[model samples]
Target: MPAWTDRALLCLLLAAPAGLFLGCSEGTGAEDVGIVCDPGEGQMCTCASGLGSVAWCRIDGTGFLPCECEAGDEGFGGETAGDGDGDGDGDTGDGDGDGDTGDGDGETGDGDTGDGDADTGDGDGDGDPILDQACYPGPNDDYSVCFPIVVPAPLPAGYDYPAPYQGNPNYRAPVRYLDLDAIDQSAQVAANFTLDEFAQSWKGRYAVLQPHAVAYVQDLRDVVGPISVNSGYRPPAYNAMVGGAGSSRHIYGDGFDLDPIEVPLATLEAACSNNAGFLVEYESHVHCDWRNVDVDVGFFGLPNGDAPNELPLLAASLEQDPHTGHWSAPASGFDEGEPVRRWTAFAADDRVLTQARGRTFEAPPETAYVEVLVGARMRLVGEPLSRRE
Candidate 1:
């Protein structure tokens, strides 16, 4: 191999841990899960609802589902399998109406708030662990306990999923997970999809966290209408072809495609440019992502690279709702009624920080953000949808 190739190889090896430590690259599913989840091209996946319910074992498979949790069942983010008949069909569940209980802080789904168990199948009586050895995910990562808190991603042992992506102790400095589940899935995300969640193992460990792309969509859509994910979560092989950065954030483990209806691309870029400081941010919609830096910054411009000191735009908080009316943003930032000032693009989760050039962006695939907010508004789900609406 050439010297550069050798150097690149070294970077992959060195960066692997760095990426993990920086709060990226956690993978999907537990090796214990006997199912394979294949979220097709540009798709991400999570497990069945009841499987992750408080003190339950979730069956894993490639499919879309809302883990069925009772009014108080808790979850540990482990995909569970529910069979009402106990026939291994992976179907059949307890008719508890508490919405997606798998995202809660309790481990047993009993709504007990105690450190619960994850082994819903070990025959340890109720399969509820005593919440012992339970440590919360640190700061700068997902603010939820239901996400990747980093458990050392060891290299894969044969064909199994890699380990959970661990973050850099130096920068991400370990912190306590706020909610027991570690994830705040309750945010009012977009129209169709709940916040897009992913389970990936990097360096050889499993971590449950949100993709930057999804986060970006959720944020932008909060002010706009439906923000579709034109693209999301690509395997390493695919990211290279898309022309990710030298330190491609995707390979480092998080990038996305966002489509917000209200904010113009320039305005979206400017607002998100400074938010990448949250290591959990994903980038790569039509245009976004943070540069690996210690400082902070932001910027805005057209997809073609034209930006003025002030641009026109508007943004809505989760407080409003698409169900009630269309989302809107500030129009005073740009010249009155200038078509060019419309929000044409945006960055994914953590990208768009420090305002770096040379990134990929695109339009959305769906306009279901309105429905997503509506779902939250009804308080049918565990998250505080009212805040998002």
Candidate 2:
């Protein structure tokens, strides 16, 4: 027997766990020496070589298990199952066993067991316990996994829905909601304003509220009595359909197009002028919102639904409606028209002209401007300029 052959057998015996003697020579049955061959599903079979080495291969339902050694150690006078060059250190094996440099791990898959660079070759990646799994795409893309979306909770009490949005499917945020049509009268949101009256005609399915804006409405009610809302919380789709402002605060559930049901429009406008928040008085209705920023208040009349005949030189508070052919004024309306005249007019000392480019023309130091428009559509022409004395 070669001296190296004796050393190889000794190494295999030492490496075996417990008192199991994996070293072998001749026809020693694997089961006789307690070598188990129970390769379960999705697993490969492994066998010990004649020289105490191992061989690993996938068991593809063939019922063919590697239970015996191929041969003893070549130089030791027996055929060895390991393809190693017979010194039996298990190094440089035929790439089929759990030798130090063998290809197989003596298990299924790649066959390499708990040895260096000898894995099941399953692409488990580094075999690290923390990161052995495959990569996952994400909740949005991966439909196989269930992911939860965060939404505001604690919806308002007694708020029922129509057939479609009932029970709040798809997990959308819910605030206070009121359906005037479904609910009874006398349950007024304010004086002369009931959910059945003002909110009953709301086109949108939901009516959310920002607490601050609600408080503003309450305050306005104290001064001007009952107020009616023409428009309130509008969904993005509905807002776009109705040609609402692209950046309208109504979409954010904090704005309202309102009108005085009992009090005069001027009285409501005057009350808004003395308070905080945004207020814009149109010909009929008053647009109010709780922006919580600088208090911006303005007044403009929509006498007709047509473009202004003459564009104002200094007073540029005239705008044309593309759909209705009506001329109206909105916040930042001056920037839309071309400056036709640059005249001065007598204005109150406290009057402030808000114009394009955030420019403020004061009445005391600067003259107030009044522009008059003529014609059917009120298209502003360059020829005539109206100045107020």
Candidate 3:
């Protein structure tokens, strides 16, 4: 017989009858004589459990092998594998599949096992995050304390001043009150004045100090030098105890009777004229109040003594959206004359989080406070909305 090649021998074996069984190679058998598919080809098939599986052709280019089901075949029924809800349905709980505590609402949970609630403690239910309510540091490296922006109705028992003073617009109730017992008495409220210095001779520990008054004193200090606060906030009862004028500005928390230490009294009077809203020249001291001044009450200093003239103070009322929890300022009538130039957001540690040019500011996540710089000179700080848990 002629010397046959491997290809010819395989063709002869494939041409034999079905009854003539013969094994060719390790991967080929007599049952593989008829071509079922190309070699190494694969197709989808149903397994014994009615689940889809993969089947590949034999190496000899004949019939396909048995369908092979992959691991985790139970999860192929419209669910993810390793989902540990104990139900094996793959629908409840968070998609992380770790099986931690969740709300089981088919949405991703924060592991608190409760529905989405803000817990901000503002009683508004607006869903804003809690913030730090501590006293923030000021620009002069001093501590700046604040009170809640909302004024209480039916003024506190001892705070309602007597008579015609109550009807006067300038003698209206304070925006908020501060508890002296809870605050540090030695805290530097301004560049040159301490909280104790301002609270001296006051009627009670609970008092109010207008921020504009502090800014005015700081401005005078910049112009002259170290000055002394002879008198600061004097509530109605304290004013009467000292035989003060019935309409004294001291009761308003914006008046300061200051005595200069080094500079001449005339120089202090001149500085007060340039910075104060109302000025009274006394023999040994000068009484100044910012009741008529239109400036940024929240700001501490006027750089280089350059205060904006006729500029209105920026309003601090922030309206919050009930659904979105975003804050927006009211339309300042000064939009045509002195528009808001910048909006800034700050964290609890006084970190600058974001800045924008629009009047509306959406605080970033974990923001503690928001402020706006208006007319390029005035800065108004909004009230802290939430308290940290």
- Tell me each candidate's TM-score: 0.27, 0.33, 0.40
Instruction: Quote the lDDT for 84 in model 3.
Output: 25
Compute the lDDT for candidate 1: 0.27
* CA lDDT, every model vs. true structure: 0.27, 0.34, 0.47
Model 2 lDDT at residue 83: 31
The number of residue pairs in model 3 that clash at the backbone is 0
Model 3 bad stretches (over 4 Å): 1-157, 162-168, 294-389
Looking at model 2, residue 108 earns an lDDT score of: 31
> How high a TM-score does candidate 3 get?
0.40
For candidate 2, the 10 contiguous residues with the lowest summed lDDT are: 295-304
TM-score of 2: 0.33
**Candidate 1, 1-389: lDDT as tens digits:** 01111101110001132221111122334232433332110111112343322221122222212222332342222223333222222222222312222322212243332112332222111222211121112222232322323222242232122221232211121121112134444432223444333222221132222233344444554545555555443333444455532233333223444445666554554455555522221223343333232210000000111112221122223222235432322222111111111122222342222211211112232222221111011111111223345
Worst 10 residues of 3 by lDDT: 6-15
* lDDT leader: 3
Model 1 lDDT, residue 169, Cα:
15
Residues 305-332, candidate 2: write the lDDT tens digits.
1122221122334443344433333233
Best by TM-score: 3
**Lowest-sum lDDT 10-residue window in model 1:** 295-304
In candidate 1, position 12 carries an lDDT of 9
